[model samples]
Target: MLKSLQNIFRIAELRQRILFTLMMLAVYRVGCHVPTPGVNGQVLASFFEGTQGTLLGMVSAFTGGALQRMTVFALGIMPYISASIILQLLTVVFEPVQRLSKEGEQGRKVITRWTRYGTVLLSVVQGAGIAVGLQSMNVAGDPVVPNQGIGFVILTVFTLTAGTAFIMWIGEQITERGIGNGISLIIFAGIIANMPSAIVNTIRLLRTGAMPPVTMIFILVLMVLVIMAIVFMERAQRRVPIHYAKRVVGMRNLGGQSSHLPLKINMSGVIPPIFASSIIMFPATVANFVHVEWVQKLAGMMTPSHWLYNVFFVAFIVFFCYFYTAVTFNPVDVAENVKNQGGYIPGVRPGKATSDYLDVVLSRLTFAGAIYVSVVCVLPTMLIGQLNVPFYFGGTSLLIVVGVGMDTASQIESHLISRSYEGFMRGASIKGRRG
Candidate 1:
């Protein structure tokens, strides 16, 4: 492991890329501390203290506690993420987008441009809403925004929208010139940045006898088990064997080879949980700010600890697991590609039959993956409701952290192997998401 760390810096390009990524992430974290103009940070923090199970808390987590601070980056990268998800959905339903998606690099650039546009638009709306919401919010008799007016609203809208756009640009730069998927890394960085504070709080509770030692032991054990499960599931794959037909080209025999298509159990990766959480939290988020009787009641029932919320959360996870898998991986295309290359699944016909076989295999894998993700994610809420475990130790956060770590390590290993250096895992390699 130490040698691998040394080898990373031995390659100048890889070292530079990593350093650059770190520098960009640091810049983002710095922005998270720079508060918006008018809001009282302490009061905002106090308000968030009581919002632990609400949408505000979830948003704050994703933003590295920026929302609680009312920082410039309070909106975070969520608007951009939401826009990207919207665009992905559009690719399936909109014919023009479908055509554009098939056009390769140029098409993707177009889609990305549109996604950015949508991000800016969303940031503006969300920022304005937040500004107005702040005006209405108070800790006791003290307003969150003491000097509230139209001026504050416009300024906040501009500040937050610009912050999100800047974050979007940073992610793109990191992806183009640094390592890993930059957006994932940004979220990973945000979640990780909060770990120290959570640890400190946990220790405070332990020292004050608010949390029993046995409870702490159980939390540690559960975390370890959950992490191990996630690692195993993320690495699991169902490899379908394929054989290339023997063919003669001139005087030489060619094209007699065997390979297996690696179909991952969680082909959808961490997307289902993210989408499910966002959708489930939307109404609750609105209810948190708006105090209508029905809205308040609805939010109460959909709290993270509520049975109704868990039921809906699990259902959404299962639904999105299948939906996202279908969107991203088309069995028909894979079968066609295989057939064009003179390859066939051992027990299946080339074309449609092979497609059907792959589809069946994928459906089963997706179902299992969905169940695994739902169980992991829902477990935290069960603990929270029954045992009062902190939300900081959520399964979704761990999933993203572990998944992103694996992906980054996989990319790093590829670079190492390409340069004839040993990877972190001796005599082995981590399979990337594509595999």
Candidate 2:
């Protein structure tokens, strides 16, 4: 492992990419401390402290506590993520988007342009909502927004929108010139930034007798086990064997090769959990702003520990697992491409039969993947509620951290292997091919 770390810096390009990513992430972290104008930072933090079990807590987690601090980056990259999910759904239902998606690089560029526009629109709306919401909130009669008016609202909106836009730009730049999926890395960095504090809090809990030493050990063991499960599941795949028929090309035999398509056990990656969480949190977030008995009741029922919340959360995760899988993978298209390359599944005939076979396999895999995702996400909630852990230790955060770590490490290994250098593992390396 130490050698691999040294090897990464041995390559100039990879080193630069890693350094650039670090620099951009540092910029983001610095921005997280820059508070938005007109907000009482101490009061806002106190309010969020009381909201650790609410949707606001979840949002703050994604933003690295920026929301708790009422920073300019309190909005974080969520608007961009929401915009992306919206555009993806639109591509499925809208003909123009679907057409543009099929148009290759140029078409993708057009769609990207539209997504950027959507991101800006979402930032504006969410920014305005947050600005308005802050004016109404108070921590022990101390207003979160001290001086509230049109000017404050406009300034707040502008600061938040601009912060989100800047974050979106950083993500794009990281993707182009740095490493990994820039958006995912940003979220990863945010979640990880709080780890040291969480660790210290856990230690303090132990010393204060709030949590028994045995319980802390159990939590640590459980975390390790869960992380291991995630690593195994993320790397698991169903390999469909493909055989290329022998062909005569200019009196020379060609095309006699065999390969297998690797369909990931979790084809949708972390999208389902993210999408499900966003859907489940929307109502709770609105409820925080609205002052009504019924709305408060609904919000209470939707708290992280509530049975209704878990039921809906699991359902949404499953629904999105299948939905996102369908959006990303097309059996008919894969079958067509395979046929064009003179390859066929061993037992399945070409054309419709092949497509049908692929679809059935994918459907089964997606169902299993949904079950895995639900278990991973819900188990942490159960643990936290029952054990009263001091900080967010698992669930969606764990999944994203492990998933992105695996992907980034795999990419690094690929670069080393391509350069004829030994990967982290001796004589073995992480595989990149997946269908």
Candidate 3:
């Protein structure tokens, strides 16, 4: 491992990319501490202290506590993620988006441009909502927003929108010139930034006898096991054997090759949990700003500790697992492409039969994957309820952390191999969940 770490710097390009990515991440972390104008960050933080297991707490986790601190980066990359998801969903129902999606690189550029526009629109709306929400928030008589007016709202909207736009740009730059998926890495960084504090708090609890040593050991063991399960499930794949028949070309004989199409056990990656979390949290978040009796009751039921919340979260995870997988992977298209390339699965006929077979296999895989993801995501809530620990120790955050870590390692391994150096694991190569 030490040699592999040294080997990374041996290649100049890889070294530069790693350094550049670190610099960009540093910028993001610095921005997270720069408070937004006209807000009392200390008071806001105090208010957030009581909001654990609520929607605001969830958003704060993804923002690296920026939202709690009322920092410039409070908006984070959620607006961009929401925009991308919206555009992706539109491709399934909207003909124009579908047509553009099929247009290759130029089409992707157009879609990307539109996604940026959508991100800005979402940022404006969300920032305005947050500003308005802050006006109403107070701890014992101290308002989170000192001077509340239309002017403050407008300024906040602009500041947050700009902050999100800058983050999007940084992510794009990292993707183009650095390593790994830039947006995922940004999120990984955010989720991991609070780890030290969480650890300190845990130790404090242990030292103060607030938490039993046995419970601490159990939590550590559970985390290790859960992380192992995630790594295993993410790397697991269903290989579909494809046999290419011998074919006569114009002048030379070709074809006659065998290869396997590796379909991931979890083709949707972390999208299911993310989508489910956002959908489930939306009502509670809206309720936070609205001071209605019934609305408050509804939000109360939506808390993470509620059984109904877990049920709905699991159901949504399963639904999105299939929905996103179907949208991203088409059995009919795969069959068509395979037929065109003279490839056929053994014992399966070429046309609809092949598509049906693949679909059946994919359906089973999706079911299992959904179950695995649902279990992992819901476990944290159950553990939190049982142990009364911090919400920062969540399954979704760990999943993202592990997934992003694997992806970054895979990219680094690719660079090492391309340069004739050994990878981190020597003969073993890292494979991320996405691929």
Candidate 4:
């Protein structure tokens, strides 16, 4: 590992990309501390100090406590994520979006433009809602705002929305010039940035007997094991055989070979948990702003500790697992392209039968993937995080960090090998072919 890292800096371009990614992440962290105007961050922090069971609290875990701080980046990259999910859903439910999704490069550009617009729109709406809502916030006996009203709200809305736009731009630049999937890296960075503080808090709790020392050690051990399990599951996949007919191309042979499509064990990645979080959190967020007693009660009912919450979370993850995989990986398209190239799934017929075979295999694979996601998500989330021990299992947080780290490392290793240098695993150099 040390030798491979030494070789990494030897490659000028790879080193620059790594440094650029770090710089952008540093900028994001700095933004997380730059509080939005018209809010008392001390009061905000106090209000959220020990409130870890709520949905907002869970989201705060991922955003690196930026939301509670009311930072310029209070919204984080959630608006962009939501916009992306909206576009994906539209591709399934709307003809225009479906057409654009099929238009190749031009269609992709059009959809990307729309997603950007949606990101801006969502940012503005969230900013405005937060601005209006801040007036109602209080900590202890003090109101969180304790200042002028409408003018402050407008200024805050504009500032936060602009901040989100800036974050979106930063993520785009990172993707274009740096490393990994940019938005995922940003979220992963945030979660990782909080680790030192979390560690210190755990130590303090142990010293002060706030938590038993043994429990802290147990938690530490569990974290290590969970991390390893995550890595193992992330790399697991099922390869489906694809065979092509022998072709004679102008007195020479061209296409007579076999390959396999690798269906990953976690096909949806961290998207399912993120989607589940948003759906579960949004209602609780609105309830926080609403003053009705029953509304407040209903919001409490949506808290992560609730049985319904876990049940719905798992169900939603499974639904999205199949739904997103179907949208992102189309069996019909795969079958059609394969047939066009005189390819078949060995014993299966070329067209419709191939599609059906793929559908069946994918369905079974998706079920396995869904089960894995549910176990990973629920074990840490519902079981461990409920202890109120100041330990942030942040299951999705860990998943994104691990998954994105592996991917970025794989990319860097590819770069090293492309230059004929050794990768970290030496003889076991990892690779990812196009899906």
Better of 1 and 3 by TM-score: 1
How far is 192's C-alpha from truth in model 2 (Å)?
A: 0.6
Rank order (by TM-score, best first): 2, 1, 3, 4
Q: Residue by residue across 358-402, what tens digits does model 2's lDDT show?
A: 999999999999999999998887787788776765688899999
TM-score of each: 0.94, 0.95, 0.93, 0.93
What are the per-residue Cα lDDT tens digits for candidate 3 across 291-382? Answer: 78998788888877778888899999999899999988999999999999999999999989999999999999999999999989888657
Pairing residues by index, what is the TM-score of model 3? 0.93
Q: Rate the local accuracy (lDDT) of all candidates.
A: 0.87, 0.87, 0.88, 0.82
lDDT over C-alpha atoms for residue 225 of model 1: 88
Question: Compared to the true structure, candidate 1 yields what TM-score?
Answer: 0.94
Task: List where candidate 2 sits over 4 angstroms from the true fold.
Answer: 421-435
* Residue 176 of model 1, lDDT score: 90
Per-prediction tally of clashes: 0, 0, 0, 0
Candidate 3 deviation (Cα RMSD): 5.6
